[model samples]
Target chain A: MILPEKTIERLSKYRRVLINLNFQQKDYIYSHELANLIHITPEQVRRDMMLIGHSGTLRRGYEVKQLIEKINSIIDGNTVQYVTLVGVGNLGRAMLNYLKNKNKYLQIIACFDNDQDKINKMCCGIPCYSINEAEEQIKKLNINIAILTVPTNVANEVADILIKAGIKGLLNFTTMPLKVPSNVYLEEYDMITSLEKVAYFTQFIE
Target chain B: MILPEKTIERLSKYRRVLINLNFQQKDYIYSHELANLIHITPEQVRRDMMLIGHSGTLRRGYEVKQLIEKINSIIDGNTVQYVTLVGVGNLGRAMLNYLKNKNKYLQIIACFDNDQDKINKMCCGIPCYSINEAEEQIKKLNINIAILTVPTNVANEVADILIKAGIKGLLNFTTMPLKVPSNVYLEEYDMITSLEKVAYFTQFIE
Candidate 1:
């Protein structure tokens, strides 16, 4: 069954919190406790767990490891997903550094940039190719997902190139509104909008 | 009136889209058009507009300039908000570059880092200070919001210091779950979870 976008986002958050709990050696967690960690309501947590066909007794709560395995099967399955990063600027570099070996399922296999000096160089052990080579290299590497960090002016053009090159998913960091085919998936991560949201809430907090 | 967090986020997105429309010299936009640009339902856009006490006629839709003014009043008032960054690492630096002069109401006034070599230097025209001087500078500068981009291990400790230093809002970039006082507002921006969400949708897209 297809889940709502909001539900998928919450499931991802729950999985992260569960992994952290496992690392902390916490084997069991109540819905309310997990909700508190992620700043959501207990009922919301319970509803999400139910949607995924998982349940816990009111007394025992959830098993962290088992919940994680269930979520992994739903979100990632058995195969690992290979991702590529476009635009090796500051944001791109930061993402590469932060995500290096961080996840076993999702890995950034290669990167693309327009800078002549950066092309053919290795960033965080991931090969960097020129934007001109993005299409050829993406196909050769069998990359399915792309993280777009290009400037706003070039975002749409770069998105077009990636989509045409058979990119199934795009995690957009640029502010531009990109038009992709219905078959392609797009997720925009706008930092300024996010910060402004925080600012709005901070002012009206009761 | 206390608006829901989701409403605030949508408001932020609407404001951004309006700004882009204004840039394109578009005076009026229908809710459906705005929703199409942002990938949301028209009803959601109309609901957000209603929450902000703004409405449009069926003929002209919403006046782009008037809607922008209304949102500005709701999200940001007459005075600009002063923000500071806590880490000058790759993520922080990229954010600084992306946000420089982007918003007139919100400005990143200063930055803090523990790196001795980075202290006393300038990044994007913003002065960098040692983490030890964070409290002193934050208090003196009247900085209420902080962007925490430090490593996971040090995120909590630095957050504690910032909260004790009188920071009312935090835009956390680290992966660790931080516990702040009830009075303090916190927004966590985890890129990995966001990427995973994209991955999930890309795999399940029907």
Candidate 2:
């Protein structure tokens, strides 16, 4: 069953919240309680839960562990997905360090960079290869997804290479608006845009 | 004018694209051309421009420079907004380096960290202070905005302090769900959720 993009996003968020609950040894969670934790309405939470075909009893609410498994099955296919990181610049390196081994299923196996000095070096124990070797390394490692942190000038050019190398999805960090093939999924983490959003809203307060 | 959130986001995107066009020595741009660059519908672009009280001519479209100035006037208030970065960890340091002087309107003037060793040291020429001094420093510097890059466990605690420090807005990078007062604007940059979205979409490709 194909789910809407918004639903998928919420499912991921729900899984995170459930994991935290599980860590705290919480066995069950009411829809409204979970909604409050994530700052969403109870109706939206119920709607998302229904989309995953999981219904909670009125008394027991949602079984934390079981709900996590259900959401994982829908989103992660219950398997580990290997990802690659391109560009080991400041932002890229920061992401590499922060994301290392954080998730059980989603792992960044290798990284690619154009800097000859960084090539053949390991960043946070992940092997760094030259951009020239990105295609070969991706295929060898079976990498289908990539996080792009290169500069804006070379973002699209490098994206072209990644797409041609058979990457199925991209998490873009550069400011450039990348044009990927329709078959490839693209998610942008535009920091400037987000910061500006905060700036725009803060103006109304004062 | 109380523009919608989505329109504000689009306006930020439009400003970036227009800046790039201006850098390339292009003066005017049609709505369709701008939409194509940002991968949005021409109608959406037109609607956003209308919200900001700007319009394009039939022949010359919109003057790129004028549009940028108009958007900046609305979003940035034609003056610089001072911001602070909390937690000078790897992510915080990278953000400090990446955002330093990138915008004339937005500046990260001070940073806060709990580490006593890092306090009183200069990072990227910005002074680092102990987390205990955040509130006083925030008021002293007249900073109303902050970027929270602290660990997940301490995210909410630090955020609470920031809110109490009179921070009007925050760009949250931690995975933890933060609870702030209604008057405090919060924007979360959840990288894990974003990566999972890519992972979910990549499943359908194969």
Candidate 3:
């Protein structure tokens, strides 16, 4: 069953925390204990577990390994999901380095840029191809998700190209808003807006 | 009047779009036109404007310049808000470069890191001080907001120092969860969760 976007994100977080708990040799975790780790309410955690059709014993609570496996199956499915990055600029390079080997199921297999210098070079061990080769590379590599870090002027242009090349999901980091087809799942992340929101909230905090 | 966090973020987005519209010589915009630009519903835009106590004329729609001025006052007070970055890693440097001179009212004045080799260096024209000097620098800079990009192991350790140094707001980029006092505004942005959410939704789109 398809879950809400927010629930999926929380499940991913829960899996990350549970992995750490499992590493620490913790066998099981109460809903409140897990909730405290991620700063979510116990009621919310229980609701998510219920939505995922998982139940825990009153004595031992939810099994850490079992919960993680359930979330993994829900979010990632079976095969590894291949991703590509478009635009090898500062943000793109930073993302490439940070996400190089971070995920087990999700991998950034390649990157594309219009810069002559960046093309044909390796960034964080991922080969950078010219924008001209993006379609061929995407199709050859079976890449469905793309992380877009191109300039604002060329963001939509690059997005259109990526979508036409069979990209089903896009994570946009450009300052400008992009208009994509309804079939494409788009996630827009704006650092400026995030910073501004933090700044705005600080006033009420004090 | 205080606005909800989501509304504040949308206000920031609307201002960005409005500034672009102002640059294009557009003077008036209806709620629907503004909503279309940001992919939000027209009613939501109208409600946000109403919350901020702004009105539009039926004949000409909302005056772009007036709305921008009103939003500016609501989001940002008269004085500029100073910000600091912790951990001058790849993500931090990219943020500094991308944010330098980008916002008139918000400025990232300084950054802190524990690496002695990077200490006392200028990154993107902002000074990189030793993390040991974070408290002094934060107090001297009158910084109320901080962007945390430190390693996951040391994120909370550094956050504690930053809190003691007078930072009222935090934007955490670490994978680990942070626990802050209620008076401290914290925004956690986990890129892994964001990417996973996009990947999960892509399956349903097709």
Candidate 4:
């Protein structure tokens, strides 16, 4: 069975909750109870589990240990993949800080910036290098994922450099859409579009 | 005709592109061209327009002036709402700065923080008040929409406060599921959950 894109996202979240519960040594859980934590129907949880090929008991929603193992196996807990940030702006820096302390599964190994003052320095113990050193540093650091935090005007340009440097996945934060090779994957996060949608949704509140 | 939820979001984005084109005084945009700008299919743009019932000429695609007029009319331009911020953390402050000066449609009229040093100071000319004064400030400012950026530990508690203050719509950034009334709409923007989902999707990349 194949999981849908949106369902995989929910699976990651469900895994997170299960991980927390596992730490607390909480054994039994009901679909209705898990649904209450996630603000969704218990039936929806069961349906999502089916996408990932997990079967649950009637009274109990899912086995916490078994569910965590299933989700982890599906989520890919193999070799650690290192990621690099391309820009050092406000949003980029915030992401840099977040990636450093959070996400034990992922590591932000290096950062690239054109700013001379920001170069040759360490932010939260991660090295920052000139954009010219990208290819060299990527090989040196074994970084596979590139987080594009550069400005819109240069997003595609930097993306080309990252792709050429052999980055497999790109997490793009710029408003500009990068023209990438079909082999490389792109995920964009545009705050403007998200907030505007929030503003629009506010209009329909009953 | 009432706009679908997704269509409303696209229309909000379309408005921005139209504003850009209007500044350049360009007339007659093609659906394909708008699709490129907004990163959607031409068929999607047409379907969105159909949802709004704002008919545009096939040759013209959608007239910039005419489209703006229809959108504004449907969106109720007279009463632009104010959005309140409940936390003064990095994410909350970043949201304030991100939303500030991006668009003039909605304003961050007030911000709340429990820290004494952060309270009463002007953040981008919008005053920050104490969390204790949240209900009073919400009523005084007549704000209906709120963007909750508090830590996950206190997200539910703060949401209860905002709901009590007559907040109709909430854009929650915490990972926790809130138990608000059916009338109060909630949307979560948890970065940890989002990034984990990204990690899950990373496997699908060829």
The candidate that achieves the highest TM-score relative to the unseen native structure: 2
Cα deviation at A180, candidate 4, in Å, is 4.0
Q: Once model 2 is optimally superposed onto the true structure by TM-score, how far is the C-alpha of residue B59 displaced, in angstroms?
A: 2.3
Docking class for candidate 1: acceptable
How do all models score by TM-score? Answer: 0.84, 0.95, 0.94, 0.88
DockQ-best of 1 and 3: 3
Q: What value of lDDT does candidate 3 attain over all alpha carbons?
A: 0.88
Regions of candidate 3 where Cα sits further than 4 Å from its true position: A20-24, B21-24
lDDT of 1 by residue, B98-118 (tens): 776777888899999999988
lDDT of 1 by residue, A66-155 (tens): 888888888887579889999988878888887767667888999999998889999878999999988998899888999998877788
lDDT of each: 0.85, 0.88, 0.88, 0.76
State which candidate has the highest DockQ.
2
* DockQ of each candidate relative to the true complex: 0.47, 0.70, 0.66, 0.44
**Alpha-carbon shift of residue B8 in model 2 (angstroms):** 1.9
Clashing pairs in 1: none
Report lDDT (Cα) of residue B104, candidate 3.
Answer: 78
lDDT of 3 by residue, B64-129 (tens): 888888888888865698999898899888877877776777888899998888899898789899
Question: Can you list the residue pairs that collide in candidate 2?
Answer: none
The TM-score obtained for chain B of candidate 3 when compared with the true chain B: 0.95
Query: What would the per-residue lDDT of candidate 2 be over residues A2-36, giving only the tens digit for each residue?
Result: 89988988888888877765533888889998899
Off by over 4 Å in 2: A21-24, B21-24
